[model samples]
Target: MLNLLSNLICTALLSAPVVSEPANPKALPFEVSAYVTSENKIRVAVEKSAPESVVVLLRNSKNEILFQEMISKKELKYAAKLDMKNLTDGAYELEFKSAQGAIRKQVNVATKPVAEPARVILMNTPAE
Candidate 1:
C-alpha cells in the first residue's frame, strides 16, 4: 500500500501543470505599471524588489511635477491610485521612486467620471 501511494504521488507531481516564465525577464530590480482602474483614477502597481517607501509623482509633458505623494510600502506587491480630476487631457508621466531605483510610465488622462449606482435605505423609529 505504501509503495502504491508513493507511485501515485509521483505521478500526480509529474502530471501537474507548469507555469512558464516570461520569455524576456525584466532587468530592473523593480517594476511599476499603471492603468486606468476607474474614471479619473489611475491605478499603479509596484512589484519585484522589496521596498520600504516610494514617492509617487505626476508630471506633465514638460517634466514638471503636478502632484506628488510619499507612500509607505507594506508588502512586496503594492498598489496606488492617483486622482486625475480637473486635469486637462494629454500625455503625462507617473513616476515611482524607491531606494532600488525609479520607474516611470507614460499615461494619457482622458477617462470620464464613473457613474455611481443608486442606493436606498429603510429606517425604523422606536416609540418615544
Candidate 2:
C-alpha cells in the first residue's frame, strides 16, 4: 500500500502544469526591517541570500542624513544599532538601498510624560 501511494503521488506531481513566471518580480532580493527600542535606539536588520552591496541611512525630518553606512557584498547578514540619545525627539527615517531596489521605514522618537505622585493630608488633631 505504501509503495502504491508513493507512485500515485509522484505521478500527480509530474502531471501538474508549470506556471509561467511574471514579467516583473514582485519580491525584493533582500529582506529588511527596523524598529525603535525602549532605550531610545533604532535597531536595523537585513538578510540577503546573495552577495550584494547595500547601504543603510538614517535621516531626520528635514531629509538630512544623520547616520550612513556602506555594507560590503560579502556580508550576507547585517545588523546595526543606532543611538538616538544625542538627537532631539522628532520624526526620522531609515532607508536601505541596494542595486535591485530601496526601502524606507519611518521612525518617531518622543519622550513620555512622567506621572506626578498623589498628595496626602494628615489629621492628627481630630484623632486626639
Q: TM-scores of all models? A: 0.52, 0.69
Error of 2 at 22 (Å): 14
Model 2 lDDT at residue 78? 91
Error of 2 at 29 (Å): 2.2
- Each prediction's RMSD over C-alphas, in Å, is 19.0, 19.3
Off by over 4 Å in 2: 1-26, 121-128
Model 1 lDDT per residue over 3-113, tens place:
333322221001211112232235344566666632446677777565467777888888899988776666667777666655675777777676655666666654334
lDDT of 1 at 94: 72
lDDT of 2 by residue, 1-128 (tens): 54333322221001111112222334556677666554556677889877898888888899999999998999999998887766766777777777777776766665544445699998778665
lDDT of 1 at 40: 48
User: What local distance difference test score does each model get?
Assistant: 0.59, 0.66
* Candidate 1 residue 87 C-alpha distance from true site, Å: 0.6
The 10 consecutive residues of candidate 2 with the worst lDDT sum are 11-20
Tell me how far the alpha carbon of residue 46 in candidate 1 is from the true structure, in angstroms, after superposition: 1.6
